[model samples]
Target chain A: MAEKIKILYVDDEPGNLIGFKASFRVDYHVLTAVNIPQAINYLDNNPDIKIIFCDQRMPGKTGVDFFEEIRISHPLPVRILLTAYTDVESIIEAINRGNIFRYVKKPWAEADILSSIDEANKFYTANSMLMVKNEELQKAYAELTKFAYSVSHDIRGPLSGMLGAINLAGEIDDIEEIKEMLFLMGKSLTKLDTYILSMHDYYSLQRGELKITNIDFNKIIDDLKAMYMVISKSNKIVFTTTVDQGEVFRSDEVPLRLILNNLLSNAFKYQDKKSTNKSVEVSIEVHKNQAIIYVKDTGIGILGNHIGEIFDLFYRANFQEAGSGFGLYNVKSAILKLGGNIEVNSVLHKGTTFKIIIPSI
Target chain B: MDKEFSFIIIDDSELDCFVIQKVIERAFKNLDIISFQNANNALEAIKEQGVKTKPTIILLDIQMPLMNGFQFIEEFEKFSPQIQDCYTVIILSILSATRAPADIHTEFNKRIVGSIIEKPFTIEKLLSLLKNMGLADEKIVLSGKKLLP
Candidate 1:
C-alpha cells in the first residue's frame, strides 16, 4: 500500500473540525482537534502528520499563535490557515505570522480542500528530498577539502624537493661539477615524473575516461624491452624477453601501459648495476582463458614480508627513497577497475617477479 | 698525493644512490663506487671491512624499510671506533618535510647533519655536497661515466 499522508484539522468549533474530517478522512489519514491544546496533543501522538489545517479564529488562541509556540519544538508540519471571506485581513496576518503554506477559505468546496491537501503533500516531499541532497553535498564538500590538503602537502612536497636540489646544484661555479649537476638534475626530473604521474592517476580514477580496447601482449612486451634498453645499457644488465603470443583482453591499454612501465622500470631499477651479467626478462603464457605476463629480473629482490602490502597506497619499500609509491597503487586500482588481478613471486637477494593475469577475449 | 677510495651508498632508493654513486665516480676517476639497498646487510659488511684505516665513505640514506639512516647509525655505533671513523654519515632523502611542520627548514639546518641532500640529487650539488663534506678534490662518476668537463 502507498504511504498515506496524515493531516490534522484544528478549529474552535467542534462542527467545523467534524466537517473537515468528513471531507478528507477517506483520501488522507485525517485527525480532528476542536481546540489548540487538543491539536498539539494530536500532533504529539501522530508524528507522521505532514500537513496542518487550522482556523484563523479560535476561542482563546489563534492558529498563527499556536503554530508560533510549536515552531521551535515540533517544526516541519506544513501549515495552512483557514479563514472566512470576511476574515481576509486575519488570513493575510496569519500567513505572514506563521509562514503558512497557504490558506483555505471557510465553507470551502470539498474539491478545493482535497486539491490543496494534495499540493501540500507534494511540497512536503520535495522539500524533504532537497534537504537530504543538500546534506549529502555538504558532506562531499568536507571530504573533498581533506583530499585537496593531502594532495597539496604530500603530492607536491617531493616535487618541491626536486626543484630545490636542482637550484642548489645550479649555484655551483665549479667547471668540473657540471656533469654531476646534470646527473643530479636527471634524478630530480624522474621524481618530478613520479609526482606528475600521481596527479594523472588521481584525475583518471575520478573523472577521466579510460579507453577499453584489445592490446597485443607480444607487441607491448617487445616495446617495453626496447624502451628499457637505456636502463639496461646503463646498468650493464642484459635485457632479455620471451613472449608466447596470446589472445588480447578488451580493457583500457593506458592503464596497462602504466602498470607494465612501472613494473618493468622497477625491475631494472634494482639490478646489479656493476655486474655485467645481471638481466631482466619478460615472458607471457596463456592458459585456461587467462593471459599471464611475467616480468622477472635478476635484481635485489623484495623482502618476503613486503610483497603482500606493496600495493597499498602511500607505502613504499623505501619511503621517499625514489618512487612515489603511487605506481603499484595505481596498478592495483586499475586492475580492480578492469576486473583483473596481479600476483607477485619474490625472494630476497635472488629476484622478484610480478605475474599479471587478465581474462583473454 | 691523490688518493682513490670506494664509497658504499646505502639507501633504499636505488635511483638516488645510483645518481650519487655515478656523480662521485665521475668526479674522482679512481673512487670505487658500491651500492647497497638495505641497511642491516650493509652495516654487517661495513663492520666486517676491518678498520685499520682505509679511505672509505658511506653515503647513508635516511629512510628505508627495515632500518632508517639514524637506526643504521645507532647500530654502527656498536662497531669499533676506528671502523666508525672510516665512514662519514651523509644524509640522503626526499627530505620528507611535507609531513613536518612549517619550521622544518630551520630544523634541517641544524649542524647535526654532515650534509642533507635531496633525492635525484644532481652531479653539481653532490660535488658541492662532496666539497661541503671536504670530499670535493675529485671528479664525479655517473653510471660508469666520468663527469668532468
Candidate 2:
C-alpha cells in the first residue's frame, strides 16, 4: 500500500492473464506467467515481488502441484490461488501444504483482487514483526546468561582464597578457640561452596555444550557415597539405597553427577535442625525407555506454594537455609538436555523428595 | 608449591608495599629490600649494576612515573643474564583484579618476568602464599613481633 507492490500472476488463459494485468496494474508491478516453469522463472528474476497468484485450471500441471513443489525450492511470496469452485479439492490441498495464504474465485472482480493483495501484504508485515521480536528476545537471553557466568567465576575465585586461608588456620596452637572457629568456617565454606558449585552448574547448563556418556546407575551411586563418606560420618547421616541392584543408563555423566551431588548435598544441608535422627534414602527404578532416581531426605521440608518454581534459576525455597539457588535449575536443565524430566514432592516439617527421570537408553 | 627465592620490593607507598615486602622478608629473610620513589631512576640504577655473583630478587612497582612496572619488566628482560637473573618483576597494582600471575608465568616462563601480586598485601595472606612458594618453614612468623615460643 505504501508504494510499488509487485505481484506474479500465473494462468493458462492469455485473456484472463491480460485481464489481471489490466486491473490494478497502475499501483503494482504485475508479472504474467503462462505455466509453472514461467512462474518460477519470474519469481527468481524479480525477488522484490511480494505476492503470488496462481490459476488452478492449467493444461499439464495444476496450481496445487506447482504450489507443493514451490515450497521446497523457493522462498515463496505470500501465495493466493485463483481457482473455480470445481477446483476446491486442489485449493484445499494447496492450503494443507502451507502454500496458499488464500483462494480467490474465478471471474474475480478487480476490487476484490486488489483487496486480497492488501490483506496478504498486511499478513506479511505482521509475520516479519514476529520474527524480529523473536531475534531480539534470543539476544537478550544470551547476554543475561553471559553476565551470570562472569559473576559466578568472580565469586568463586575469592571464595577459593577464603577457603584456602581458613583451611590453613589449624596450625596455630595458642588459638584453641580457632579450632571451634575453623569448624564454623568449614561449615560456612561448605555452605558457600555448595552455593558456588550450584551457580557453576547453572551457568554451565545455560551456556554449556554437554559431554554425554554411558553410566551404570549403581556404580555412580557407589562412587557418590565414597565421595561424601567424610561428610556423612561427621553428620551421623545414615544413607540407604533401594536401587534395583544392577542397572545401567546412558546420559551425560557431568550433569548427571551435578544433579545427584546437588540433591545429595541438599539432603544433608536441610536436615531437621532439632531432630537428632538424620538419614537419606536413594533409589533407582526403570520404566520402559526411561530411568527414575528418587532422592528422599528426612530434612526441613518445602512449603506448598514454593513447590511450583523450585527449578527457577536462583529461586530459593528457604531464604534462611544455606543454598546457592542454582541446584534445582541445573538439575532441570541437565534432565532436559538428556531428553528427560524431573519432579519434586514435599510436606512442610515432614520431608522432601526429588524424582529425577532420565531416558533409560 | 614453588621454589623458595630471595625477593625485594621497591615502592614509595608504605602501606601499599608493607605486607608484600614483609612477606618476602620473613619467608626468605635472605632477601634484600630496595625502596624507590620513581621507576625511571630505578631503571637507570639497575642498568648500571653491571654484574652480580648471585641473584638479587627485585619486586618492581607498576604505578611509578617515567616507566611503569610493565615497562620496567620489558627493560629488565633485556639486561645481561647476570642482571636479569637477579631481576624478577612483579607488577604490584591494586586495580587489575582479573590479571593473574599466570599471564606472566606463560609469557616469561622462567625468564622475562616473575608474577603479579595485587596490592594492599596482608601479612596473614602473604604468609600463606609464601608457604606455598616453597618456604620449608612450618609457621609463618607474624610480622611486627617475634613469634611466641
Candidate 3:
C-alpha cells in the first residue's frame, strides 16, 4: 500500500473493538469509537477517515440512526453496518435510507472484515473521482452552450442585415443609389466574414495546445505591417513599429501572433476618422527573460466604466460600428494561456494604448 | 389607415430599420413615420412627444445591446396610462429557429405586444397585420399589384 487507509469502527462491546483493532491495525489505521458521541467526535476531528463500520445494536441510538445523523454532517465517508443478527428487514431499511456501502454479519470473520475494508476503500476513491469528473463535465457543457448561443447571435445579425439590403438593392433602379446600397451590403458581408474568422480564432485558442519555439520579433512585425499596409494607407494613418531585441525570444508563436493581431486590428478599427493626425505605433522591448510590447493608437477610446468589461465576450462599447466583440476576449484568453499580462490605458476621443508583458521561456 | 396615426420602429439594426421604413413608404402615402436605432433615445423621444403624438404602432426589435425590447416595454409601461394607451407594440425577431419562451410571450402580451414578425419581413405580412389591427384600409400598390381582400 502507498499509504494507510484511515478507517473507524464503532461498537458497544469493548472486547469486540479490541479484537477488531488488533487484527486490522497492521494493514490500515484503525480507530475505535465506543459510543455514538465518541464516533461523532472522531468524525468531526478526522474528516479524512474514508470508511466507517458501525455495530447495529448499540445503546440508546441504533447504528442506522447514527448513520442517518452523520450522513448529513459528514456525507463523504462510506458507511457499513455490523450486526450479530441476520435481520433482513432492518438491513434493507438501513441500506435504503442511509445508502450504507456494505452490511457485515457479526461475529464477523477476520478475512471477511479485511476484504470489506479493502473493497470500501476502493469504492471511496472511485466515488470521489466520479464526483470531481462530473463537476468538470458540467462546466465544459455550460461553456459549449454559451459558445453556440454566441455564434448564432453574431452570424444571424449580419445575415439579416445583408438580406434586407439585397432586397432593397433589387427595388432601386438608379445606379448611384444601388451603388450606395451595395457599399452598405459590402460592409455587412465584411462584418459577417470577420465574425466567422473570430469564431475560428476562439475555437483554435480553446482546442489547440501551445507550441513553444524561438520567436523572431522582427519577422513577425514585418508580416503584420505587410498585412495592414492597405488599411493604413487608405485611412491616412501613420503606422510604425520599433523593435529593441538582442536575442530571439521563446514562447508559443501562434498565440503571440493572435495577441498582436487582435490588438493591432482594434487599434486600426477604432481610429477617429475625423482626426487630422491618426497614428498607430507598436513598440517591442525584449530583455533576457521577458518581452514588453506597446500598441498605441489615436482612436475613439473606451469609456472609463466599460474599460474593465472590454475583454468580456460579445461586449461592444461603441454600438454604432460593426464588431464581433470577440477580438479583445480572444486576445486576453491567449495571453492567460501564455503566462502573460496585458493592460489598457485610454482617453475618450483622444487615444488608447495596450501594454503587454510576455515571459520568454 | 387613419392619417392621424403613424408608425414607429425601435430597432438597433440600421438595415432592419431601413427595410421597415421602405415597406411603410410603399404601403401608404402621406403617413408620418419615425424610427430610432437606440432604445433609450426612442424612449426619450416618446416621453418628450407625450400626448401630442397620436395613436401610434411600435415595431420593437428584441435583441438590442444595452436595453432590449423587453426592457423597453418595462420602461414604456411606467408612462401614464393615457400615454401608454396610444401605442400598440409588435416584436420583430430574426432568430426564427428559436421562439421566445412561453412565459415571456405571455408577460409581454399582457402589457403591449400584439404579435411577432419573423425576418425577412414581407409586404403581405405587414399589410395583413395592419389590416387586422384596423389600420390599413385603402387599396394600395404593393409589389406592383393592388392589395385586395
Return whichever of 1 and 2 wins on lDDT.
1
Report the CAPRI category for model 1.
Answer: incorrect
Task: Score residue B38 of candidate 3 by CA lDDT.
Answer: 86
lDDT of 2 by residue, A66-147 (tens): 8778877665478888887655566568788747898888889877788899999888778778878989889768867754
Clashes of each: 23, 1, 0
In angstroms and one decimal each, the interface RMSD of every candidate reads 6.2, 14.8, 3.0
Reference-based lDDT, each prediction: 0.71, 0.67, 0.84
Full candidate order by TM-score, most accurate first: 3, 1, 2
Poorest 10 consecutive residues of model 3 chain B by lDDT?
B140-149
DockQ of 2: 0.01
Q: Against the true structure, what is model 1's DockQ?
A: 0.12
Lowest-scoring 10 consecutive residues by lDDT in candidate 1 chain A? A153-162
Model 1, range A1-361, lDDT digits (tens) per residue?
Answer: 7977899888888888788778777778888888888888998888778999988788888888987877876787888878785556776667777878887887888877878888898999998889899998896687576556445534444455455445445445675665665665566667667767786885586465767677677778878877988877866888787767645456677777777888888887776555556878877776676667788888778877888878866566743346665778788877766667898888877888888887654
Candidate 3 regions off by >4 Å? A1-66, A81-90, A104-114, A144-150, A215-251, A267-317, A332-361, B1-4, B96-100, B109-111, B139-149
